[model samples]
Target: MVTLDKDLASIQEVRDLLNAAKTAQQTLATMSQEQINKICEAMAQAAYDNREKLAKMANEETGFGIWQDKVVKNSFASKFVWDYIKDMKTVGILKEDNEKKIIDVAVPVGVIAGLIPSTNPTSTVIYKALIALKAGNGIVFSPHPNALNAILETIKIISVAAESAGCPKGAIGCMMKPTMQGTAELMKHQDTSLILATGGSAMVKAAYSSGTPAIGVGPGNGPAYIEKSADIPLAVKRILDSKTFDNGTICASEQSIIAETSNKTAVVAELKRQGAYFLSTEESAKLEKYIMRANGSMNPQIVGKSVQAIAQLTGLTVPASARVLIAEETRVGHKVPYSREKLAPILAFYTVDNWEEACELSMEILYQEGAGHTMMIHSQDDRIIRAFGLKKPVSRVLVNTPGALGGIGATTNMAPALTLGCGAVGGSSTSDNISPENLFNVRRIAYGVRELEELRETPAPYTETASINEDLLVDTLVERILAKLQ
Candidate 1:
């Protein structure tokens, strides 16, 4: 009898799925915009119907986020995301400029390899499927080991509905056995036209290094600055609501709180009133040890865990009503776990002298990490808000709203999306909130708009046989061409 190892099995699975997906993508490439949207609508509807069940499965399998909050995330991926992208054209003629003599046509990007995170498995699967199919690209998902069951079930539901709506079979595939080796194969596969990578920094970095075109996200360590002119109570409420939601699993969730010295007293009081527990110097030390591992990555055990759960893990006595944990700190570095991305119900607090000081501090913190993710500020002063928004390196500058919700466009009017691109500075290809449009490329059909000599301001008088010094001219042209080539 012969037995196969999991790694070989995983690699075989990846090859089979990609081959089938590539064929299906060929059929999708010929689909019309309306046909693609119809199939996506069916997929979205099926996801919405199974949201609760998938959410429960994700929570029970991974034991990361709250099941109830996952339900909301699933709904956002289904209805909200679908509503935002339902009408936008992603195929056929995207734009036609008669005056400019240019016509823009959308082309499918072929097969996409998606990397799913355990933190938001089901929701991420649903969202990626919607956007990928909307653009007429077939997708294959590599599920996180911790959330494989939920992801597989979600894929099954959506893919069935999609096929029912006339989408080609094998257009949406998920690996049954997902391993690191298998994921690498998926990313490096020649049939994979692009990779939509979302997960830990290591996995995202791996995607980029696989010699394939990829769009990835970096770690988020956004700070929420409570300016002096802001509504203190409302600001704190928004922070708590965001932090406690899914136990801070979202990468866009605020990792730290910054306040002007003038508003420090009121901010702290409001934070305390609304279910925040400030850790003492001793307690902070205890929790910091568990926030990150010896190698400095976020500890998976605490990720998406509630304050009570984290406190128990760290052997600290935290109140039952505490929605989040706070640790006042004056330092920022990878060595200091509080200053890094915790991805749990833990926040670091800092105080600045004024708005300008707050701005400087925020910039410094983001520079330390999360250079192109998100930042939040609460202020009624338009001038200050404008100034604050100008210099930040983050992709999104959320104002007067929860970072988790606002960054993902649930609260803000930015595009409703699950994958938020961090731009070039954050190691992502684009800064846009990723949509179906992002999954396809635009091919420009352009007409000759001008004469060749019109490229220069003053034309050398046009005559076919007017030049006299042919030998000298050829020598000069050859030298210039050599210079340019060199």
Candidate 2:
């Protein structure tokens, strides 16, 4: 009875939030780009100012990721994202082509349903709010229950700042009482224009199935391939740095390392030199059992955990200096936990005979789970880099950089985003990095370039046409033949 009451309350709360968001979005949609920018600036500053506090709150509430790293993420979501999108035009006439006599107008997609994840709850909220508002759209967040406090706190801060800066009230809101029914209601609501979902595969699938246009990101099991011609130490260092960043909570972080057999010795030596602890056969087996749940999903208890905590959980002893746990793995499947997305400071190591073999291995690993997400290759050879970029089934083929930072556009020229789309190949609607531009639609205005007679002037193939003239000629010939027969 209590559970039923809670669910009913959540559904009612979703309805209220949706109504408020719809009204706020209508007001926001009427504002000019400059006015929207002012509100976005205020919200970014507010989020940046409270970055540390919110990071600590998220860590304390969810017990995931490092507070220090979360601070960096918060800064990225606010300052970096704002800097990248501050100059952009998202309203009114965005483009004009004098020669073609065409104009492009940007249109906001109204209220956006944002699904916040537990790993980066506060930062995700800040990022989504910034992008949604930058596009002159209102956002209603469905926060992860585990990180509700941080999500709500971030939303409150941003909403206050935005309203103070001449933004409409209720432009940014979050579901304080989060439940499955509430989130479903929020997504399927008639007023919800789009869903920007960033969570597990099941949650993303649900978002797509909610009868709303959704840009959902899927699970990432990216593999970092260290070619023979690459800088072994630098590659290993970047991988370790990325995997250990926020304790490997980022989806784009590398889950496995594929190195050429010619460079296997050097790769292993560099990995060990950079604080990687390789597990024994027995240790790997023992840890594998705890990597996934009985139902084959990632175990929440081990996500974003430190090496020491993970060691304790699996009853393995390792040096205090260890930064990441490495397991030599050959198989790739859902049953093989080591070859899957661990979301912690853990890695699977594979050796290949050459770059070709390394490419095949990387493809195999990604196809097993993370296709159309991200892949990294460290190679000085431009040909090899281009080859991987052309053949790999990933949205981002990062070259000579950390997967986590590069994929999110911190170390690369790509758009900075918390939600990285995996594309249709990965069962997502888009392969973009989820920017403000994605939150809006464009209306094209084109003048008639040619006369209607010009279309009829072009000749078509005989087989392509079934015109009335041909039919009349055929009928005439048939009549003539019938008359001759008579």
Candidate 3:
């Protein structure tokens, strides 16, 4: 009897998928912009139509988030992402400037290696597939083992639609038997051009360490600041809505709320009014041990779990009206679990003396974790908003909107995307929202505007005993010639 081990089978499957993606990408590179856009449109439509079904499957398979919220995420990926990129030019000539004598040509980055996380299974797959095809690149997805079936179904739906609309036969692929060894093979494959990594720190780190170019997102512990000049009720509503959406699975969701001491009472009252349950000191201490494991990473028991589920896990009595769990804290560090990225409906509340204190506290929180991910500021004072925007290490500063939705460009105009790329400060290649523009490289077809002598021209140094400055002479002649021509 011949029995293949799971790792060996996964590795073999990854190799085959990589080869197919490579061959398909070669054909994709020759596609016109119109052809690529049509295929992408079809894929987006197909995914959007199956959004609900896929969302349900993701929830059932992974037990991460609500199926309804997953539907919204799916719709954002399919419709919002498609609308933003439908008119984009990703193939052939992109721009031409006769005056500059340079033409920008879009070139696909070859086969892409997409690593999907269990947090956002179907939506991530659909979004990656759209942007990859829009840029005329083929992609192979390595679905997280926890959400394999849902991810596989998503890939099948979109890939079939793409192929029906003139895409290459194997332009999009997914691994049914995902393993660490298989993922390694996919990232380090000879034909793989880029790795679009969206997962845990270990997996993202592995992608970067695979000796391949990767855009890997880091952990997000964004602080939503409620300045004195902000709308208290509206700000609280936005924060609660964002943090509770999909149980805060999105990395960009707010992890903490910073309120001014002057408005602390009002903020707390409003939070309670809006279904926020504050845990006492004892409760916070008990829950802290459960938030992070002994390994110094997030505890899976609480990740993407609801308030009721989390209370049950922690053996605490929570109100049925509680939409989110709040813990008052005065510290920020890895040791302080409330100050870190929980990735669930658990939020830390901090009270500061003023907006300046809020700013410094927010920076401290981000420095500890999620350095270049996102932050939220709700304020009518443009000065304060601008101040926070200037020195923060975060890539995006969402204002007066739900962090989860706004970060993905649903309620905001930032490029609609599911994979939010944290900047170099967070160890990502780009500080973008991960769009088609990030998927392709540009080839500049430039004309030789300067002669060899012009290139050799050097500015003569200023001195008392020297010949006329060559730069001065050229400038004076050029000005006179221009005047005469005019």
Task: Compose the digit string of candidate 1's lDDT tens values, residues 222-315.
Answer: 9999989899999999998898889899999999999877889999999999989999999999998999888888999899888878887889
**Global lDDT of each model?**
0.92, 0.94, 0.93
- Pairs of residues at least 3 apart in sequence or in different chains that clash in candidate 2: none
- What is candidate 1's TM-score against the reference? 0.93
The regions of model 3 sitting more than 4 angstroms off are 457-486
lDDT score, residue 439, model 3? Answer: 92
Judging by TM-score, tell me the better candidate of 1 and 3: 3
Q: Write model 2 residue lDDT over 226-292, tens digit each, in one string.
A: 9888988889889998999999999999999998878898899989998999999999999999999
Model 3 lDDT tens row, 374-447: 99999999999999999899999998999998998898999998888888899898899999999999999999
State model 1's lDDT: 0.92
Relative to the true structure, candidate 2 has a C-alpha RMSD (angstroms) of: 5.1
TM-score, candidate number 3: 0.94
Model 2 scores worst on lDDT over the 10 consecutive residues at: 459-468
TM-score of each: 0.93, 0.93, 0.94
